[model samples]
Target: MTPRSSLAATAAALLILTPTPAQAAPAYPDPQPVTGQQIIHDPTVIRLRTGGYVAYSTGGVIGARLSRDRVHWKDSGNAFAEPPAWWYEYNDTGDPWAPDLSHRDGRYWLYYAVSSWGTNHSAIGVATSPSGLPGTWTDHGKVLTSETTDHWNAIDPAVIRADGRLWMTFGSYWTGIRMVELDASTGKAVQDATVHHLATRPDLPYAVEGPYIVRHGRYYYLFASYDACCSGVDSTYKIRVGRSTSVKGPYADSTGTPMLEGGGDLLLEGHGRFVGTGGQSVFKDRGEDWLAYHYYDAEDDGTPKLGLNRLSWKADGWPVVR
Candidate 1:
């Protein structure tokens, strides 16, 4: 196990992503020396309006890390000051969870969720960063919430503007992956009464969440991580993907089960030695594309740590997590 202490020299290194097959990927973040602890998970990256990159994570403490290069993130210090008080007032404990940052039109919108497991009392919200900084942030309040027993906990917020519409993808435990379009101005579900179910695990014995959707070529690839998370040293996470020609899909895996009806094309699995490695967030680095997420680094006493791996698509247009 490479102790965080052992990562001393590696921390300050100049880490940048260059196009490469996952196999030939470099050891992430060039050799540099820095100091700090990374206490976060399920990070989502957005290329800023000015073209800088800001990463928002599963912030239980309402904070994030900033990096000039994709690697070597420097903790930015309490980005949210503290969890919103209304989170408790409404009894919705999912506050300060996974956050996705983006600059749209002329403002920076931070979309996030609040919830707890085994409960349907969850909500998704957004706060605006007028100037895109820790202070001067404004809460847009809860954008949406789900109390449906079949929907599971409503957290892990990811967003994309596709097909001339703004859509949000999220889920956990029950009901698997769900998607809905948003009203451009309001940033709430379009309520055009359109919703799509992407995947579920009635057979896998665990939950599937952390969905990332993007269109490539003629395919809408739905990428997700499956299994249990938050169980220290004992997690069951793996990356998975499915594809369909339509944005909202009846996505199918290799064997051909529709993602809408609960199916996936396996992209990566936690090999026995790795145990649990999931809670993924995929983004385009300076190069083509890569995935940034937390994994139980076997070399680090199996402790969950940040990891970024460059990925490539197979000839058939499916993703392979190298």
Candidate 2:
């Protein structure tokens, strides 16, 4: 054999006999810089089947943007030209926040939040579209809601397929994050489905939100934002993650602390002018994982702007934004 082939064969044989060393999670990389109409909050991104990508964010009628490449973006307009009438029942302004996008059976499912700030009375609504373009969605009204008496606030919805079922997770502040099985046919919560309490922090600020779960290999990773947000530069938001073998966890961080008791591995934090990097959603584009979120731009007067980073998992199974 040639020297290169002999070296490769020997390495392969060694790998077969030697146990792989644990991989240390890499440090979070600087956010990929993108410009043009970047103001957005609670962004979720998806690649269009035709070409390019679209990101839906919180604002009047659910603001959206389009990008030919993932880096440079332009405003595509809002999902709804006019706010859905039913949304006014939950909030007078009828604006939406934290839209989650999922694809199934050649259609797109969009779940968003409707509520007045600081109130437990909130609603999570779903909209459907054959083409995930601006103004193509049909409102499906509220899939779940919360009242003053309810322990959980229904918002920031994310849907994933796990255990051969569709599940939607939503919540914020009041009682942390929650999940329930969804009816794949109707894109609604399955009737009589038990709501599963996933993660929480009962401490004073009670700040946990933006739950996004994805099943990778044998483990389900739950990603969430913790601490305060929405105050621009003063925002303290950071992204954290936990993993469990089952969808309904007892998820824990690398240190084996339960997520329900404030156990989470820190995945991303503010650096320099990027303050409060949180409200993240993970998507695979062209076979590589990417994280989409909003961060306060300290140099730009703390304007909330869209941030993107490549996500990589260690050999030990911990995710890191690199």
Candidate 3:
């Protein structure tokens, strides 16, 4: 063989063996922008068993909306035409607060809160339906509550199955987020399980609430909303997160600071037309992780509306919503 032919073969071999860098994953705000119906708060989204998507939020009888394509949404009435007769026991306002929706067995569970403002006297209730459609839920009565004598407010209920058990995370205002075990069959707390205290911001307005827990890879992430909400243009709510290896956590932020010590990694904050974005629930659909929440729209006269964003993981495994 000619000397030049030998050199050409060596060059071609090197070109074929040189590694090409893997393309960096897209950083969310997925070019497919999020658009939907207006007028929802503390929204929790779930894909239907048959098809389509549904979101439930805080408002009269727990407001609900529907999405045929998971992009466009329309008002689909509510869970109740009027507040349940029993709702007056904990709240006279007739509106329920942040709701957590989940499916198990052959039923859909919608857990919500009925409580007065600025008080720990609150109750968390659950209703179930075979299909998660508006006006089809049958109220199962109270799942948990707190009295003036208790330290934690029993609001903002989020449910997840982890470590082989159904667990609930709830609380607000007074003492921060708390969790308890749920009986898989009845959707109620386990008869003798302890109520585990999770995250808190006792020194900073004590404003953490709406705890959504999801398992990603090998870690369990707890997402919470922080600071003020419901003030319209003056709202200051934002989302934060922490993680633990165990379902019941000694959770810590990205920096290893304990969540109980006010440790939270910032996830989302107000920007541009979106103000006070918080009250989040995380879910996976079609292999993509999404953060669903409510935001005060500065452009819409500070009206609270639904907000959804794609969530991406960093190289180190922290979750970010863009």
Candidate 4:
């Protein structure tokens, strides 16, 4: 209990308890770098039942790809359904566009669009696989078709189930975002009231497609990519959003403005070597969320490719891939 001994003990205690000023909190979410596959487009990521990653995209001309990590990709090369012998248009861009996927009752369902830009002859088709990989698909025929340049048409297909109802939202140039009800068990359109627009456009991009619908918190967030996609460096793709209380319609942007009125908040724009990026699907993994999509890589010949980034939500309620 000497004075000198007590003084030494107090100094050591203060040294142990002292905190560094550099331990400040982050003002923004930390951006995570993506281990991207060069030129992979139309990214669709699924968390398998066994806690593995399965990503599909506009891969091989005849098949999809499977990947454990987001970076390395391998083509399954399994064709669940061959290009319908009926298909004749599209120049040569066959079996491309949005991929709507879900896992239900131990089975996986995939719906994709078949269309060429500027043509209303597009159709949305359904495919199923027991395992969420390629080649095991069962093409369930054409689920929906679009007007032949005469009407707002079907293109991008996005499906989500909420409130005891399964809904599919899709569209492009002709009208805009529209929805349809699907049988929970059979996965077929159930309601004749299938056609409904999700937004209003005074000057929104005419060829708006790539509709990805996800429910976050109490709001259903509809994120759609706008502008011309697949144009390499000249692409003008961007991500936009609208939220609604109902899974169905009347979704609005952050300003309480209807998405039809162009109320969506811009989530991402042209950045980095990627100029145009869209065709987004949000995925939840490892208790975190991510944005899976594609973009044109300007650094590498401005080729349209796949890009996956983690979607971090801000305090302000906007989502971004960092």
Candidate 5:
């Protein structure tokens, strides 16, 4: 062959041998098997001090589910018998979404969002329950709110206590993930708190939401759902994560890509019968960290269902969902 032709042939061979991005994508694992009352969305689960696990999600006035073994769930009821009168300010039906459940100061705090579809006029509300069970919660009213004029959407709240202060990470679509300080005593936003930006898409519609922060070892990790959700099998939702040394972050992924610039390491995504895995939270059980989220089950006609996975850390301290 001519030398010029040989060089062209080598270039073509290299192109043939190099894997495309899709071909090089990692094979993701399916969620551990869960049975009974698996249908859910934006699930936040925690093991109670009194024993067993309780989960709150988006539906039916903060829908509730109970699980004994963490593998079998049963629908219990709504956290509240009826919506608070103030919730009607955001939505006509008074619907709530994506609750964060945690135990602090001998009480259970539930933080959730209320808003209509496709609008930034939203509020994050707080409530307290002695047992973290359905029907026992007392609504404390709005903790934070966003008007249509605001750049950030006030939704998908996840709170963590760091440096002896309470902080909540929340946002969606409008400008991605954001954080603000909370009054520890009241579980409400600190008066005139600074809203810190965390993550976003480089493009329009942004598409990142459901921010959850967990402190693992020396780093504070930020986990957020990316792309669209709620379209059943057509949903493109996936979970991604980044880490920073400080809870109020300039977080970056494993490759040093800043989350503020739309960078995150993929932690979980759809595979096989599981589709659109996102809306995630992290909690510890028996000293082992586990991820709790909802996935659209393709085998079940794209019904959103409970998904749990144990998280194992790399030697470098990054989380890997097992």
Candidate 6:
């Protein structure tokens, strides 16, 4: 071969061997369109047997909103006419945060967290309502609590039943997500229940919080919010997920990275008008799974608003927000 042709062949070989940079992951989809009474935070939504949908969120003594078509919502009122006296023990203002709503035993169970900002002295309280409507809840008091000395912060309670046993997962920035067994009859923690650590960051000031677990097929998927929240447009909150074969997980992400070691698959994040998408929960409505969360609206002065998205599953049983 000619000397010039030999050099050209060597250059072509080097080009084929050099690796190209990986493409960025696709942008997350926006929440489905919702209208009216959209302002909310850390929202937990459920369908009532009587019909329509009721959403309870963190504000105004557990604020309530009702929707007849799931597209439009109207302010209902606070879940309680007055704050339970016990709430004052944790916070002077008697303010409550993230709440989880569910139906069991022919009644509605409401679990909520009360705490002051930047402290671990928090408690998760439970209330029951026959009608699951505003102004009808009967406070049953604190289910569990955490002190400043404890490794885990008690907040963001989410419950799931697996293998005929009730389990409650709750935690915050202290150490990350932790779970404890709950007595089905009382909706409270079982005596000396095991506190299982689910996920956390390996670095200082672990920022993971707002955990919700759902049993899909043969695995339990743990969804959690990562990074700072409650800062309106400046919040860095996003959602991540991991799954385990057992309810009390050694949960790991899609790449087989364990959640305990700062591993989580990025499920969703801020995009355009929807900023700081976090504080998420999942529930089924009419046989279709839905993701209920809160996001700060960039177009509306950074007001936090309710966000709803349909959840579709892949063939591998992993969830995708549609």
lDDT of each: 0.69, 0.91, 0.87, 0.73, 0.95, 0.95
- Which residue runs of candidate 4 sit more than 4 Å off their true CA positions? 1-37, 59-63, 78-81, 86-94
Q: In model 2, how large is the Cα lDDT of residue 36?
A: 76
Report each candidate's C-alpha RMSD, comma-separated, in the order given: 13.2, 9.1, 8.4, 9.5, 3.6, 2.1
Off by over 4 Å in 1: 1-37, 49-52, 90-94, 148-152, 204-206, 271-275, 299-302
Winner by TM-score = 6
- lDDT per residue as tens, model 5, 111-214: 99999999999999999999999999999999999999999999999999999999999999998999999999999999999999999999899999999999
The sequence of per-residue lDDT tens digits that candidate 3 reaches over residues 178-213 is 999988888888777788999998484588999999
TM values, all candidates? 0.80, 0.91, 0.88, 0.82, 0.93, 0.95
Per-residue lDDT, model 3, residue 8, is 98
Better of 2 and 6 by TM-score: 6
**lDDT per residue as tens, model 1, 73-159:** 677765577777867743455357777766677887887777765666788888777666666577877777778655455677778
Off by over 4 Å in 2: 1-27
lDDT of 5: 0.95
Candidate 5, position 77, lDDT: 95
Model 2 Cα lDDT, one tens digit per residue, 28-124? 6788888777889999999989889999999869999999988899998899999989889888888798999878888999999999899978999
Local distance difference test, candidate 6: 0.95
Tens digit of per-residue lDDT, candidate 4, span 1-322: 9999999999999999997568653232222334444456777778887656676666453346666665566656634455654344532746566676778878998877777766778777777788877667777766777766445666778889899888888877665778888787777777564577886466644657778888878878899888777788999988888888888768888788888776787887777676787888888888788887777777788876666678877786667667
